[model samples]
Target: MTPQDSAGRGLFITFEGIDGSGKSTQARLLAEALRGLGRDVVLTREPGGSPGAEEIRALVLEGDPDRWSAETEILLFTAARRDHLERTIAPALDRGQVVICDRFADSTRMYQGLSRGDLRGLVDQLHDLMIARDPDLTVLIDMDPDTGLGRALSRNGHEERFEEFGPDLQRKMRAGFLALAREFPARFRVVDGNRAIELVAAEVREIVLDALT
Candidate 1:
């Protein structure tokens, strides 16, 4: 393990990507690698890390697509995120344990912001006020939206509210993420996610190591 400074006790890392960009897979592999190196790691995902949030996740992902408005979706996501951060992420980092989250604030900014349009600044303001800490680093796994949507459809056997928006909306979602990364270049590292899993894992491992060292 790399030596830490007096204040650099724990590292908070977030994985962001459009659906089916393999963010979850990469996050899991990264966490496994960190654990193998004897580091304490907390692995979790957004919109459902805590028990309450997980229940919300099921509702958000399984409900009828037409039943939810863009604003409604955004609200639910933020609500889930607030609980997740409070119940799961904060405590792990406070203990000097690395937290590898599957999706974090970026998901809301991208999905809610782009698909839903401007929402009177609700998403950004709420995030600023609620989330206590920003991630130390955010790794964005990027892939073609069409390809990603196809992968998601094949894996899930159907699309949900947000997922059913089709390729165009998904493309815009990717753009939203790129915009956010650009808005915060120093903290974000974009990874080409169009490659095989092994290749992607190698790149992700290097990024994590670089951040830790």
Candidate 2:
């Protein structure tokens, strides 16, 4: 358990998955559902939740696929996360509001940590030395890599640098995420993303509701 939980601070919930896994949509739906139940919810996303992080988001997410080396990217992500934690997540939790984040350090773990090389240890070291916290709950939206890649590419969005890696990376990321869930089973709840949107949303709502209780 985190210090926040033991101290009666609010819950920190994060969604994780390969690109285009519908995790973002699920995050929005879950936030809306929780608010409907009269809960105080602070819906946010990583690499851009706070103003400073948003700048970092552009740097890391846009430009060439090799815009920066994995090592450099890890440092940049950590910096943004630190700013986000101090300015946004920490205060909201202290005020006892549910902070629903679209993604967190887990993304960094898969992307910069495992993607280009085996740097999970370095990512964890920085996280432990700096952030030193984890979400109270993490929802992993699992789906086939090719389907996810196709869906993500269809968006034609500007922040498509990572998606540019194509289906191979997506497959690896999907496996990495599932492995991460197994590694932290206590804080993880995997949900299938291949189902209908409404069905997925309903399951997400139920999972979060149970956590809230």
Candidate 3:
């Protein structure tokens, strides 16, 4: 019972976690593994995956974390999501391709919703209104907040705005993510991400392949 069924609609898998939890690397590794099996896979990321959304990614991910209010960030992310769905994710799924995304609405639910304020309700409202898609599976790579922060900052990436929020928010985000997993157990799978990359990836692959069956 692989993701593709009789109707051939395909699967949508998203990775979510605090920064440096290795979700991004796992996402890529999963995509490569599946492709090696000859599955039609489309690997993409949000706040990206489409041209318009990539432009918005720069706006949201760069600069100061305080640059945009939570409300404004929600709007920006929602707009990018709508464009991405229209231009990238939807079409790929329509063709019976597994779409593996680095992040999706859950990130918005965590970052803008819980961070800086209790705006989860607002985030859900926008999600239900403009972007109605949910991933078939969400692999949340659980990690130690301090270690995750150190790994994130070590990258010295331009998208350092969120990492610049420092370890406190990372701790909050990690707990919040675990809470989210509990809230959505059917689609959520938590993988310990503090191990060697290969071990983490092995568990991730097993979880996903199990879901496919």
Candidate 4:
């Protein structure tokens, strides 16, 4: 079967951002908006969707961050994503539903690939090995990592491994995300995350509607 056939009817869309980018907020809003349009939308995330993945997520985020090497961290994310795709994402898409994920492959490219080292090639390799299909659209909520991290610290009240990354690492991660966006301009859409939530939500809604159409 062809790639389209492999992808089936489900539209895979992912939201990517640093700690305080409001990615979860926007992703949820997008899912709700799509559901309002009477479409079946499955909301999922990497490193924590499925039961197994949720366990992995805790280990990766809450456990000893220094214990795991960058490659190990990247592989863990890939493993979690592979499970999420096999059990949740791909199936939902095949059934003609809309899948809105909080984060996906690009997160690896940014957090692990860039911050840890030049793992760009490895990110692509993971995509080839784990993800059978590219997302229909990817929305990158671009934000200043410091601002985002500050927001996270203020609102969420704590920082995770990725969130605690230094300013230099965060900058590299941000640059990596932009590069990833450039790699798939047609499928990649960037939304300024510094705006008011309502305004960002509105922009995301427009992009999703346009993409679906």
Which residue runs does candidate 4 get wrong by more than 4 Å?
A: 1-8, 156-159
Task: Give all candidates' CA lDDT scores.
Answer: 0.84, 0.92, 0.92, 0.81
Query: Model 1 Cα displacement at 41 (Å)?
Result: 0.7
Misplaced by over 4 Å in model 3 are: 1-7
Residue 121 accuracy (lDDT) in model 4: 86
The sequence of per-residue lDDT tens digits that candidate 3 reaches over residues 1-213 is 654442255789999999999998999999998877668899999889999999999999999889999999999999999999999999999988889999899999999999879999999999999999999999999999999999999998899999999899999999999999999999999999989999999999899877666
**TM-score for candidate 1:** 0.92
RMSD of 3: 1.5
Q: Rank the candidates by TM-score, best first.
A: 3, 2, 1, 4
Which candidate has the highest lDDT of all? 2
- Looking at model 2, the pairs that clash are none
- Per-residue error (Å), model 3, residue 180: 0.4
Error of 1 at 191 (Å): 0.4
lDDT of 1 by residue, 68-181 (tens): 776888778888888898899888888988999998878887777667777637778777877756899999999999999888777864335677878988898898889889
TM-score of each: 0.92, 0.95, 0.96, 0.91
The order of the candidates by lDDT, greatest first, is 2, 3, 1, 4
lDDT of 2 by residue, 69-178 (tens): 99999999999999999999999999889999999999999999999899999999999999999999999999999999999999999999999998889999999999
> What is the C-alpha local distance difference test score of candidate 1?
0.84
Instruction: Compose the digit string of candidate 4's lDDT tens values, residues 7-66.
Output: 336778999977778999999998887777677889988777788788788778875558
